[model samples]
Target: MKKAVAVILLAFALTGCGEPKIDGSSEQAFQTSMQKVRDSLAEDKRAAFNDAIQVIAFSQVSMKELMQAGSGDEGGRALIDKKIKGALAGKTGEEVIDYAHKIKQERAANQ
Candidate 1:
C-alpha cells in the first residue's frame, strides 16, 4: 500500500511539471516587441504600414478579449468580441490575432 501511494504521488507531481505557464516575464516580452513595431512605423511614416498596423491592432485586441473570456471576465470578453466583429474589416479574426503575435515576436527579435 505504501509503495503504491508513493508511486501515484510521484506520477502526479511529474505530470504537473510537464505543463508550462506564461507568467509576467513572457507577457513583458510580448509587449516590448509590439512597442518596437509601433515605433518603427512612426519613424518611417509609411501609409500602408500604418494601415497594416491598424488591422494588426484590431486582431491583437480581439485575442486579448478571447483570453479575458477564458479567464472568466465575461464583460471584457464580450466587448472584445463585438469590437472584433464590428471594427475589423479585412482579416479573419483568428488570422489577424495570430499574425499580430507573430509580428510582435519578429519585431522584438529584429530590434
Candidate 2:
C-alpha cells in the first residue's frame, strides 16, 4: 500500500512538471487583440500608438511591470499609464500587428 501511494503521488507530481504547451494559439489571440485595438484608434493617434509600441518593444521594462505600474494608479506609474493609454487610444489590433511586423522587418534588414 505504501509503494502504491508513493507511485501515485510521484505520477501526479510528474504530470504537473511537464512542459507547457507551445502552440501558437496564444500568439494568434494576442495579434487578434492588438488588431482590434489598433482598428479602434483614431487616425491622428496612430503615430503615437506606433511610438508607444516601439517603446514597449525596445524598452527593458517587462510587460508585467508595465501592467503593474498602470494598475498601481499612483505617482509616476499613473503618469506613465496615462501617457501609454493616450498613445494607444483609438488604435486597432491590425495596426499594432502591422507595426510590429514593420519593426521586425526593419530589424531583420539591419541585421
Candidate 3:
C-alpha cells in the first residue's frame, strides 16, 4: 500500500512538473486576436495610402492635361503645379486618385 501511494504521488508530481497544456482552443484564440490586430492596422494603412494616391492622381492628370494643352510651355507647368500642389501636399500615394480627377477638371476649364 505504501509503495502504491508513493508511485501515485510521483506520477502526479511528474505530471505537474511538465508544461501546462495550452490546448488548441487557447492557441486559436491567440492567433485570432493577433490576426484581428494585424488586419485592422492593414486596413488603416490602406485607407491612408488610398487618400495619398487620390491626391497624386489629381495632380498628375491635371499636369498632363495642362502640359499637353500648352505644348510644353513653362508657364503652363508652373500653373499646373501651383494649382495641384496645395491639394496634394499631405496625401499618401494611394490617395492621389481623387485629386487627379479634380485636377483634370480644373485643367480642362483653364484650357
The candidate maximizing TM-score is 2
The 10-residue segment with the lowest total lDDT in model 2: 18-27
Give the CA lDDT, 0 to 100, for residue 67 in model 1. Answer: 79
lDDT of each prediction vs. the true structure? 0.53, 0.55, 0.51
The positional error of residue 21 in candidate 3, measured at the CA in angstroms, is 49
TM-score, cand. 2 vs. native? 0.33
Give each model a TM-score: 0.26, 0.33, 0.28
Candidate 2 lDDT over 1-111, as tens digits, reads 999999999999998664222122344554565555555567986576556587545433456667776676465464554454444344454444455567667768999
Ranking by TM-score: 2, 3, 1
Badly placed stretches (over 4 Å) of model 1 are 1-25, 46-50, 57-111
lDDT of 1 by residue, 1-111 (tens): 999999999999997653122122334543453444444443544344445546555555756676778899989876764554343333332333455557777878999
Which residue runs of candidate 3 sit more than 4 Å off their true CA positions? 1-70, 90-111
Backbone clashes, candidate 3: 24
| Global CA lDDT computed for model 2 | 0.55
Candidate number achieving the greatest lDDT relative to the actual structure: 2
- Look at candidate 3 and tell me the lDDT of residue 89: 46
